[model samples]
Target: MITVVGTGTGAPLSPDAGAALAGAGLVVGGRRHLAAATTMPDTAERVVLGPLAPALDAIEQYLEKPADQGRVVVLASGDPGFFGIVRALAERFGADRLAVHPGVSSVATAFARLGLTWDDAVVVSAHGRALRTAVNVCRAHPKVAVLTGPGSGPAELGAALRSSGRVLVVASALGAGADSGTGSGASTGTGTGTAPDSGSASQSGERVERVTPAEAAARDWGPAVSVVLCLDESRVLSPVRTIAGPPPGPAQWALDEGEFTHRDSMITKFEVRALALARLGPRLGEHVWDIGAGSGSVAVECARLGAAVTAVEKTLDGVERVRANAAAHGVDVTAVHGAAPTVLSDLPDPDAVFIGGGGRELPAIVTACARRARRSVVVAMAALDRVPAVRDALVAAGLDCDGVLLQSSRLAPLPGDVTRLAATNPVFLLWGVRPPARDEGVAQ
Candidate 1:
């Protein structure tokens, strides 16, 4: 049978945990982990982990031994399940063949030290090829704790967040490496995993508390926490988990302007937006750029269809409002916090582009959209004089161009006794499509 042992807090071996090492005929673990089990009666034959491949081979060799011949104990740090080697071991051997004795996981200890409730936090590892998933989760959630390895450690994460104006608290090396005011931004005492309650260290003493991302980055932080401070709070993804999703309901959207909190003269009218969404035809596996995404109605609708979208607008209030709208719709649209044509550089390329507002930059933005868009570009113009220029820009970029003037009449009360048709201003929707050369020639 395979017995898993957790070296309690990585300091002293508990009486019960120490006893696990006494009669074992085989012990498997990292060199340092097994070495921490010094209290064993020295009757155990040790198997050291070198390069990963060799370690797996050693574990397989130990499994070949006859049952009841001798006991085997595998040493793991913290809980063996939280980003540990236990999963691989279980996959290799059936669950019935092993018994696990866990140590306090680093995450539990980290939370305990912080004295913060992490029931709503997601635990992820940045030890792989990319930190993007962890970063994305951080952007989507209120709280997250990332386990670090080489390359994509705290510094790397901090550098990536520097773009989105995010703040990070890098707590490195917990337990032993927590000393010297390094990773955690404070020097911690050698005591075990529980919090000291003061929330911070005074002078030379160590404890748990909040520290600035800059302060955390300046030190040689230990294996610790990467606390992400959002560009804004709404970016947080709720930390609740469920076995399944809720039941579906009618997709009642394309709401009127009165539903949201928007600035005067800043909302997209539903009629115009419906046409834009119909033309955009958002779907999964596609990316769209919604320029001048006021109220973010188009972005939200497209994202609701599962297409990844990015909204670009000028005013900070407009940008934040767009983000709030997108979040309310439960769609993933990166609400860019700056003006388009300038802020569009950092974004990923798009498959489709939509322009809602502009001045002289309108034609240039349209041209850029045409060149960048793999399929199509859509522009909504408010002025009649600007249409010729926008249409010319699209056709100049070699796209098939079309335009429609949309004028809607709202029903409003003309007198206390009767209602009349109140016609609103006209809007020009000029669309451009880059059809395949074969199809383009077919029209001839």
Candidate 2:
């Protein structure tokens, strides 16, 4: 039988775990975990996990030995089940062959150290994976915990979030290292895994440093960092969540223009926003760019629908307004203070884009957005003369183009209290989707 033991953030092992380690025929774990273990039998074969596959194979081989003599114990950091080695072991040996003893996860420990609750936070792991998605999650959520590894640690995360207005709480080595263990350092079968009353590991030398993104990026946090908590301090304790993680998408999107602060009347109308949002099809894990963000109505609405959104506006006032509007809605929108076409090249490729204002450069902006958008691009234009050029740009980019003129009239109360239709300005909404390669032949 394989027993997977979680070495909680520097906490002393429990008696049951100690006994299991004492009788283990083979112990598998990282170099640190093995070094910290005091009860492992001298006869126990040790496998340091440089790569997980070989260690798993060793466990399988040892388990094949007669049941009378084989007892394999695998040690892992924090809760093995939470983005840990337990899933792999369970998959290889099946759940029936293994028993899991979970310790407190590092995420739990980090939050405990901060004296904060995490039911409202989104937890993501950047360990051995691309940091882009984790970065995007931080941009979209107010509270997030990132599990760090090798290249995807705090420095990388901080550089990506430099202007995002987030604070990084870097917690390094919550529990004492293995070299600090003060037992006989000999294998004993008593299996009493209780920690010392002095609690040296739990109380001393554990570092939890809080820094802004700029501060975090300026220096090395070293490899000892266990986890980083990215928080927007303003929203850190925002109303307790009845549901955990990111709250559900706003009940209704395509919010009214008055809902956002804008310069003059330069904002997408609710009717146009509804259609543009439908075409954009924003969702979780996707990125959407809103060019010429004006009041950032489109960007704010896209974020409300669960997409990581960036708003590009040339004017400083527009950028501030976007930031204000996003904060008002309790959503994160990266407001880029620059014009499109030129600035768009540096931003991450998007799943979708919405061009609300581009002046005379509208067609060029549309071309750039179409080239980068993986899914769709939607453009709203008030000048009728710009529609053909915009459509041509999308078509030249190998996209299927479609559009509609949205003309709406609101019911206004007349002098005698009778209602009359008041016509609003007309807007041309043009949208494009990249046609499948197979459909190109038929279209041609």
In TM-score terms, which candidate is top? 2
- Model 2 per-residue lDDT tens digits across residues 1-444: 788888837566777887888898899988878887778888889999889899999988888898767489999888999999988988888988888888788899889878899998889999998887788888888889999999898888999888888888877766654321323222111111122211232334456778778777766656667788999888888675789887887889888888999878989999999999999998866789999999999999999887899999999999999999998987889899988899998898898999999989999999999998988999999999999999999999988999999999988899987999999999999999987556655856
Candidate models: Cα lDDT each: 0.65, 0.84
TM-scores, in order shown? 0.60, 0.84
Off by over 4 Å in 2: 178-204, 383-385, 398-426, 434-444
**What's each prediction's clash count?**
13, 2
The lowest-lDDT stretch of 10 consecutive residues in candidate 1 is 177-186
* Candidate 1: residue 163 lDDT (0-100): 42
